[model samples]
Target chain A: MNLVIVLLIIGLLMIVAGCWCLMRTFHLLKMTIGIEVAMKAVTLFLVLAGRISGKIALSETFVITVMVAEVIVAVVGTGTAVGLFRKYGSMDVRNLKQLKG
Target chain B: MTILSICAHGFIYGPILVVLIYNLFNHEFARKHFFWFAGTGAVWQILAAIGGFTALNQNGQTSYAFGAFWDIRLAGAAFFELNATRFLLLLIVGLVALISVLVAHQTVDFNRSSYTNLLMILVLGMNGMLLVTDLFSLYVFLEVTGLCCFIMIAMFRSRADLEGSFKYLILSELSGIFILTAIAFLMMKTGSLRYADLAGLGQRISAGSGQLEDLLVYAALILLISGFAIKTGVVPFHSWLPDAYQSADTAVSILLSGAVNKVAGVYGLMIVMQLFGDVAPVGPSLAAVGIISIIIGALLAVRQPQYKRVVAYSSVSQMGYILLALSTGTTLGLVAALAHILSHTAFKSTLFTNAAALQEQTGTLELKDLGGLENQMPVTAFTSIIAFLSTAGIPPTAGFWSKILIILALWQAGSPVLAGVALVAGILSSAYLIRLQRTVFFGQTRPELAKVREVRGSVLTAEVLLTVITLGLGLLYPYILLLLHAGGIL
Candidate 1:
């Protein structure tokens, strides 16, 4: 049951989720969720890849490390969102164009 | 110590050594020690480069990692590749590391300890980026660098700076997805994660891959290149750069443009270039990107009202030169690219520091707001003029010689059109840079700005140091090139 199809679906969904977060959502929190969903897809693909290739331990280590890194990135993303909300009075990216040419 | 000892011990451990040293003392106690790390990192980089150069002279390329870190079954490990590309890359990293401490001291005055700590991580990330070889570690180091960049940009948590950092975060995350997907495809196809292994796989593909496999490989290559290009801000992928550079603190801008982009983008491309031997599509596509970035960056820079944004757009143009040089896929082109790497690092860092000085003194980076500080701060005026000239590829500055070399290399490589376009774009950059000079330094001092005085202390020190190097390198490139050739670095 766990095969390349499963891996392919996860990766595709993650890419779609990332695209949705970036292209559709104007809100920072949702964008962060989109990033998390997307990276989870990458993590699953890596582990399944290791399973298929018979290098489960190595892939597991990579997954664990990636999880930690993803968390940090998410935390930073959320923190920045909070900062943006406080300073700009909105979480919308369109409103944050004070530094244009 | 011998090169082997440092490569085996220090190169891998140097950043850790820096981190441990930072953690051993309180932030106040550890603030200036960051300077020591940067200084020592430069010395160690030079030693490692000498070692790498000598080794490459004897052998071709060397890869080293602790055997303990390796799973005997799996080939990839925590590793570093020392070849011509890395030799120059490390030296550039060393230069950025040394300058970053100076930038930190100037811009970060409050809660200095926290600044030092974050900067320590930043330096660690760059050092890792220069040294890491495998694809997985490259992504990790890149993210580490990215995280540090986000924090540094929004360190003050100003409304504008935070937004810039968030934009950067989003783009970087997007690039990350692209890279990881590409990497997964690569590993699934190649069954190995190491560059050496990739080379073997590339040979197999070149010998004759199925149409589907070939398409997959090309798709993966596109994804990987797009990831690096986004980081590099090469033309169509450059929206994040102006925002990031403009909204960040000036010192942060110096470090970001001077060092971070080179490590993350240029070095990333070089590593991937290793995998792309004799691929027919690589060169022409790369050249097209170079030209696009050059023209767009030059034209956009001409209209930028803010000084920081002008320099930022100009960086997009300069990076185009490097990519174009690399796209030639010839040894001379690579050499020219390396020279441009050094030249850009020196001049761009200096120019950004001067921007900092301008901001500190005049309190405005908007060109239309004020002008004519040449009479008040002669050093800033003079050093910045030299930097501007260097950036515009004016003669007697290092940029001039390197740009000429790139054009010459392109011509020799049978691309007269590109060479001519590069020349014209070089002139276009000068037009904007001159406009910049006329507006910022050469104009009449505004009534309110008449009392501006010369900047003193560490900021001036950073500007003067980079200024002298940019000027000195311009006059001294021929000898330097000869030396590099002799050293087997070119």
Candidate 2:
């Protein structure tokens, strides 16, 4: 029980850090790193929660899927960032405001 | 494996296979054979429609079963089940998917075979999303669809397109994370991630167990709503919508406005919430967002110079009607929502195709630059009129019928204010749409537009076919009502 609580706290900390990276960071690469961290947190929670409920396999599958999704999202996001860099030569979020309402 | 289930699998995977086989060849070969994918999709829709129609005639099956398909247990925990309305929803999506790809072929400049490949992936994702019964697998499919759409948007590799794709990617990623977190909470609380498990719990609660006082479930529910609302482009959560629509290719716009957002946002929410009850727990808040989208989209669309952006905002507004119907929490309301979805998908897609044709000929999509095109491009003019009138809920159009039902549902459900506001928005829509119609197609022909000729091939066919179908449904409104009633929607 104590181990589960400790794991949950670590997961929560990672979640906060991941969100901070996404919400506050301006660099696209850093933003991706933030998402990756959050994904790791989700992975931890899934496995620990599974262990708590005696469904480790189910949680592990979830972890695997999340990792796969994270990879795809990261790869695609990097490709997009490269394209943006080619077009505008910047990785800043504020620079992507051309479509004014 | 039963023969029938194998055949059912063909309906989902057959078009995907066809598209993949074509892509294995050179780009020129794939470009020439884009319609083959459409052909496969049409065949699938016809078969599904026939099956659904037969089921309707038989009053449909009452049992909801999953855990296996053709004696195949998915190693993954994902499962499949049918709602009373599944076949109908599938049939509608199949039609939209077919037309959307056909329109996309006409609109996009083919740079590679992968363009068609991405579209096939999108259709597969949407099919899985609508059909999959497990919440986790459903989210997987949703992300697949979202990823495909993101990639497709950036296919043109233009600065505007890239920016639009990037914004859309970030927002969609955020929504995805929210959905994942929500599902995790639900899974933890319930010890199962299947829809059946959640539905069973909800059933017990409704059957005199107790009022749902669980904070985790409530938190999960709110997160799910927020995630899908951002996806659906409802007001306040709709910042990326117009940018993506205006910047993406015309065919992509049709796919996005007509099908993807509807499926990912509205239908996604509906399916998840169905486990709880007919009227979802978040109905009131969703309805509030829907109303805000309607008025704000209408007001903003009227002032836009770009025709695509105009249509894009109008899409946000039209979706409001569907969402309002959904929030009413009655079978009649569901029927209204489905009906509106069909009409909107039909006319809105046709309108976007017409917009594409205009841009193709005029080299401009700005409203101010277009005038008196009817004399030159009569098919586009005539069909666009039908399309916009249908959008504005004018009589004898399917939009008219669906809007009436939605308004009636609201009033009968004791929200006369919303009914009145929706009725007034109908007039507001006509005002702007008529303004656009007159500016673009009526009055004196601009000197440049006078030489423009109507597109004489597949583009015209797609537009006319969708417009004709919308008009036909309106003309045969009674038959649709009878069919829905037969299908147990009423």
Candidate 3:
């Protein structure tokens, strides 16, 4: 129980930090990394949830599936960032204002 | 398996088969004849959904559960279930996909094979989302759908497309994380993620089982709501919507606005309501969001110069009505929400189809650059007017009936103020749509646009087909109400 609680606090703090990184970063790749960080924290939460509920097997399956999905999202995000980089000659999010209202 | 089960299974397997067969052909042939493959898959889905709905209704089954080559009877196993609501949504998916295919035939010039492949994958993802019986599976399918959308938005790799796609990716992934965290918290509380297990969770939370459990549940609820709100593109979370819609090709935009948002975002919210509705703040919070989205979406829409941006913002506004109806948490509210979703699918697709037509002919979608082409493109003009009428909830159009049903549902749910506000939003909708119409169609024909001609082929067919659906549903809505009354549901 102590271990689970310790992990929970660590996981949540990681998410907050990840979100902070996501908001503070101007580089497109950094945003993707921030998102990945938050996703990993959620993965930890899933494991912790399983530990609390005595359904580690179920949560293990969920964690694996989520990892796969997160990887795909990362790949797509990075690819889009590359495309944006080629278009704008920089990885800066500030250059992404062409479609504004 | 029985025939109805076979039809249900087809929703999952049909798209896969299309992808396989589409790839079997040579690249050149597949590229040239992509429409037949994608179109047939869409039409098959539509027929299957209708068949499944009718068969399930005749047998008096609320839900039909089946596993895709797996054992659903095992403890804690994930599976798919088909019910009336899923059937309705699946039908919309099929219909919007068909419209997107029709528009794609004209608008998507390069990467035709990739377009067909991605579109099928998108349909598969949406079908999976609709069919899943568990929260975890829903999230997986939601990501599948989101990934397909991001890819399709950036398919052409244009500067604008890449920007829009990137913005959508970041926000969508953030929402995904939110949903995952909520799912984790829910699992911590309930020990399972299945719909059956999660039912009455709100009652359990309100039963005051424990302080920690209650806090966890509340946290989960908040996460789920905001996550799905971002997907639904309502109010403050809607910044990505117009950008994505405006930057993508019109065919892709049609799918984004007409179908994907509803299936991915609104449907997820519906599940949230189904699960957590008994909580004290759930319904009112949703109502507040709904009202804000309606007012702000319209206000933003009125200021856009691009044709697709207006329609996109209008989508945000219309989504608010559905949310408001769903927020009522009554049987009538559910029915009204479904009706509005169906009508919105038809009219919104029509408006986007008109966008395709205008873009193809006038070579631009800027309202300022466009002037009177009413005579030049009579079909597109007439269809646009009908769609505008529906958007404004004018008489004898499907939007009018759906909006009325929504107001009635709200009133019956004892929120007369919301009902009245929804009524007034109809006028606001008209104000923007009229301005849109007057600027693009009713004004004097600019010298540059004087020679613009009507769009032919599949685009025109989509326009007429969607217009008929909007009008037909409106005319038939009365009988539908009577049928529900006869069935003792109203």
Candidate 4:
């Protein structure tokens, strides 16, 4: 239980840190790094929680699967973002409003 | 199971398998490949349904008693067990996927492979969700589905879709947190993850020990249901739905409002009730949520200008009716809830498809901009009218019967107030829906709508098929009710 609490706190702090990182200048690489950090925090939190509760680490397999899925998704997202950047010469989301309501 | 029946499971897996097999030979097929793929899926569903019926007749047992396809073993506990309900839910999901693909092929402009591939993954996750019985397994599939939708929405590459997708992702993440924490609590209390075991624990509660355990259970249920309610777009948590539904591409909207919301929200709620009754032992909190959703969703829906938003809010209100009926915990109530789910999917899909087709023609989904469409797209307008009336609970329609059954259940449960509220909502439903039809299709044809031709034959056929099914559901209401009873739900 104590270990789970620690992991949860770590996950919370990592999220806060990731948000802080994102709030800095909107660099794509930086944002990606922060998100990856946050994901790792989440994975660690799940693993520790399972271990502390004497539960089997089904999460180990789950995280590996999710990571592979994330890579595919990130590739698509990055490709789209890059396409938008090339079209408009900017990566800032605030200025990209071709179809806004 | 018969050899043919086992092969039917292969059929459920056929879509993904087809994609993989096709990838081996060629990256692109003829432009009409989706039709062939979807046709195969449809044929698969019919075969599975027929096989399921045969299995029922021959064995005197209807439901397949399969364990969870992917079970996780612990030192002293088993964590998951999927069974007949799960299989049926998957079959329904498979059908929804094929329909969504057809809708996509007809409406959306797929520039590349990403769109179709992501859509299939979304369907895969939804199918997996319905087939998983463990709370944690369900959560995993929920996240998978959420991710798929987030990606699909982002693929629109429009500012509106981006904002909507981000909002949806944030809300979905929050709901994911709630589901996980609630599951953790359930694990803490029951020391098991299987639905059957949790039901056993819930049943084993003696009179004195029932209250605290029930309260904790209620709290967990509240967390779980609220998570699903947000995803389901029920009121209070429904603010995100209009934007998401409006901004998403037409095909995504069909899946979102029709299958995904019902699967993630309504089906999720029903499974929860199967484990723990809907009444939430803590002074009818779930009922309170239901009543508020019904009233608020209807009231807000009356003021919506966008056609898709109106359908979206109506879904919120309709979900309230479902939850209210479920709260009664009677056979009639459960059956009413299930029946409403079937009808809502049929009508809602048709409504959204028509709205999307109209938007494509007239360049706007706003009702104010869409006056007198009946003269332009006769088939679309007629199909929309049928869907709208049925949704508003007109007589001899599936909606009316389900609404009646729910109200009857409410009355049986001694909730005259809710029964009366449901009646008022039904009336309000008619008022707004009728207003929608009159404003959009019955007036003078605007110049903008003058050149709005009927959508392609394929889109029209899809809408008509959905409308026919909606009407057929009304005609075959008894048979569906019987199926529900046979499933031991009622």
Candidate 5:
């Protein structure tokens, strides 16, 4: 039953990732958030795979540390998005035409 | 001997400490601090050479391990190895830092104390990168250097600098994320992040069923390489180089082109290749990218009107040669790559400083506005010629030896066609370089440049120092080769 749920989540995440990859007209902030959702789902998928395989989650400490790092990275990414919006008046990476070569 | 060497090792940390004390005391000690950093760097380089020689003489044997308080592991493992190669890399870091400071004293007009401090921190991080054997430690040092690069470039606070720095930071962040993801995968599979620990994992992955292991390793490699490539400004990822180099003040470009790119990008690629010997499978892929960089970079460089942008694009091409040699993985290839690295450092910095002097004196770097610099700034023009010749790979110059060695290595590796391509690239190098010389130094004086006079002593000293090294390498080719071999890079 749990396996079915995990697979469903992964399938949904893949669909979203494809959509994000194709959305060329969206704001950069939105696209970046989409990437974030996909990444998080992938991590969840890893946890589910380990659980399904019955592999012992060795060292809860390491797992906690990784979780913390993931959260920090996500926060940093959001901050970067905000900064980009402020600088260019839009978060669309396509608008960064000053350096296009 | 161990105690003495260990103390000497700690002395490499002296530059940072000096800066810290000076700042706290509000002392006007830029010159003193500069000398302190240079002196300590010289001392460290001498120590590293001695240690490296002794290790080689002893048939590659050395053992020393001090306390490491911040050993964060990906999967609960510790990696601490001291080797001769690490010592040589440390020596390179020290030498480059020392050279940068000497060059800085002449050309840089920014806040002296802060610049020296940041430079020391960057040097410290680079030294740490060379010393650490663990993957996590590698990442830590990588972040340190990357942050330093961002801060240094954005230090000017110009709109162009900010935009360029922002772009660089974002790209680097993306790459960093991928690297972390790869590290996570490795930890999940092998339960350890120590490089030696990964050796067993590598074997298991290699011998495993299907190409899953191959895909995973390549994914990690791709992430790391892409990140470092962005740092180094290799082609297809070189948009940041010209903007950053052109907009930056003089000292920043010198460090960016000469040191930052090498440490943060090329160093990472070399480390990954050395760690995993299975790079042969992807060797062709790397070679393809390198060839494209060589062709595109040189062609684009010829079309740039700005002097600095031309040098910037040429760096992209020169670094491609470095990447190509690494891809070959032959002894001769490795030797040539290292030789090129050293020679490029000398000549490229000379070019940058001389270009800066021209910019300052004439208030422009546009080739259309410059002419007959040889008669007015004889010293600058002379050094510029030597640097240009060295980079053009003229015979009996350092660049020539390195290029020939790389070609020989490619031939040894059974890629005569690639070697021929490399030769063609060499001709392209000569074409663009000759054009630069004719336009800047040999032509009749431009009306606008009539008021230009030679820059004074210190700037001239810096260029002369670097140009001397560029010329000396050719005359001392055999000894340099021996040094490379002894350095365990060959």
Candidate 6:
């Protein structure tokens, strides 16, 4: 129980740190990394839930599935980043102003 | 083994089959006849949904559960379930996909095969979301739908397309993280994320176990609401919506506004309402979000210079109506929300189809660049008027009936103030849509647009088909009400 509480705090701090990185960064690649860090924290939370509930097997399956989905999201995010770079000649998100109302 | 079961299975497998067959063919041939493959699949889905709905109703079963290959008797196994609500959503999915394919036939010039592939996968994903009985699978399928949408938006690889897809991807992923974290929290308390396990969670929370458990539940509620709110593009979290809509291809925009937002966002909220509705804060929070979105979305729409952007903002406003209805947390409220969903799909897709027409004919969707197209494009002009009327809740249109039901539901749910506020918001809807209609279709033809003519072929067909649906549904609404009254659902 003590370990669970400690891990929960660490996981939450990681998520907050990741989101801060996302908000403070203009680099597209950095944003994707931030998202990845936060997603990893979510996976940790899932594992913690499983541990506390004694449903480790179910949560393990969920963690594996989430990892697969996260990787796909990362790949797609990078692919879009590459597309943006080729078009704008930079990875800065500031260039994404073409569609504003 | 049963026909209804086969139809249920078809929702999952049919799109996969379409994707398989689409890729199996050589590129040139497949590109040439992409519509036939995609169109047939959509029509089959429509028929199967209707058939399943009738069969389910006839058997007097509220929900039917089936598995693809797994045994149903096993403990803790995940499976698909279908009921009236899921069937209605499935039917809407098919209808919107068909409309999108029709519009794409006119607009999506390059990368036709890939468009078909991503579209079928999107359908598969939405179908998966609707069919799943567990929250975790729903999240997985929601991500699948979001991924497909991002790829489809960036399919052309233009600068604006990539920008829009990237914005949507980031925010959508953020929402995903929030949802996943909430699921973890909920699971910690309940030991499972299945709908069956979480059905009466509100009572359990109120029954008051430990302090930590209640705290976790409250925290999960907040996360879940915010996560889905981003997807729904409710006012505060709505920045990514118009940009994504305005930047994507019109066919994809039609899919986004007409189907994806509702399924991925509004439908998720519907699940939340069903499970956690008895929780005290859930209702008020949803109501607050709904009202804010309605007012602010209209105010924003009033200023958008682009055609699709206005419609996109209008989507934000309309989503508020659905959420408001859901917030009431009554059977009537759910019915009202479902009715609004159907009517919104009809009119919103009609509006987007008109956007496709205007874009194809006039070469731009800038409201200032367009004028006096009424004389030249009679069908498009007429359909646009009908859609506008429906959108503004004018009489003899589907939007009018749905909005009326929404207000009625709210009033009966004892929030007459919210109901009155909703009633007045119709004027705001009318304010912007009327501005749109007068600016683009009602004024004198600009010199450049003088040569514009009515868009023909599949786009025109989509326009007429959607207009007919709006009018028919509106005219039939009274009978629908009567039937509902007879069935004691009113």
Alpha-carbon RMSD to native, per candidate: 3.1, 3.2, 1.2, 4.5, 4.8, 1.1
Q: Is candidate 2 or candidate 6 better by TM-score?
A: 6
Q: Which tens-of-lDDT digit does each residue in B179-244 have in candidate 6? A: 999999999989999999999987777435656766888899999999999999998999899989
DockQ for the candidate 6 complex?
0.92
Model no. 5, DockQ: 0.18
For model 6, residues A50-99, the per-residue Cα lDDT tens digits are: 99889999999999999999999999999999999999899998888898
Of the two candidates 3 and 5, the one with more favorable lDDT, higher being better, is 3
The whole-model lDDT of each prediction reads 0.79, 0.78, 0.93, 0.69, 0.68, 0.93
CAPRI verdict (incorrect, acceptable, medium, high) for model 3: high
DockQ of each: 0.67, 0.56, 0.91, 0.19, 0.18, 0.92
Q: Write the per-residue lDDT of candidate 4 for residues B86-159, one digit (tens) a residue.
A: 44555556556666766777676663355656656676677667656577677777877887787777787776
What tens digits encode model 2's per-residue C-alpha lDDT throughout A2-100? 675677678779878888888898887777777778778777766765776677788788888878888999988888888988887888888887676
Q: Candidate 4 chain B — worst ten consecutive residues by lDDT sum? A: B74-83
lDDT of 1 by residue, B115-164 (tens): 55566677668767776657788888899988999998987777778978
Candidate 5 lDDT, A4-93, residue by residue in tens: 455635645673673455255356556545555545644553454344334436423334544554554455455555655667777676
Candidate 5: regions farther than 4 A off: A1-101, B1-4, B27-82, B200-202, B206-215, B480-490
Ranking by lDDT: 6, 3, 1, 2, 4, 5
Give each model a TM-score: 0.91, 0.91, 0.98, 0.84, 0.82, 0.99
Q: How many Å off is the CA of B50 in candidate 3?
A: 1.3
Stretches > 4 Å off in candidate 1: A1-6, A51-54, B1-4, B27-76, B206-213, B480-490
Task: List residue ranges in candidate 3 displaced over 4 A.
Answer: B206-210
Which parts of model 4 are misplaced by more than 4 Å?
A: A1-53, A57-101, B1-4, B28-32, B67-88, B203-219, B278-283, B478-490
Candidate 3 lDDT? 0.93
Candidate 2: list runs displaced more than 4 Å: A1-13, B1-7, B52-77, B82-84, B200-213, B278-281, B482-490
Which residue pairs overlap in candidate 1's backbone?
A: none
The segments of candidate 6 whose C-alpha lies over 4 angstroms from its true place after superposition are B206-210
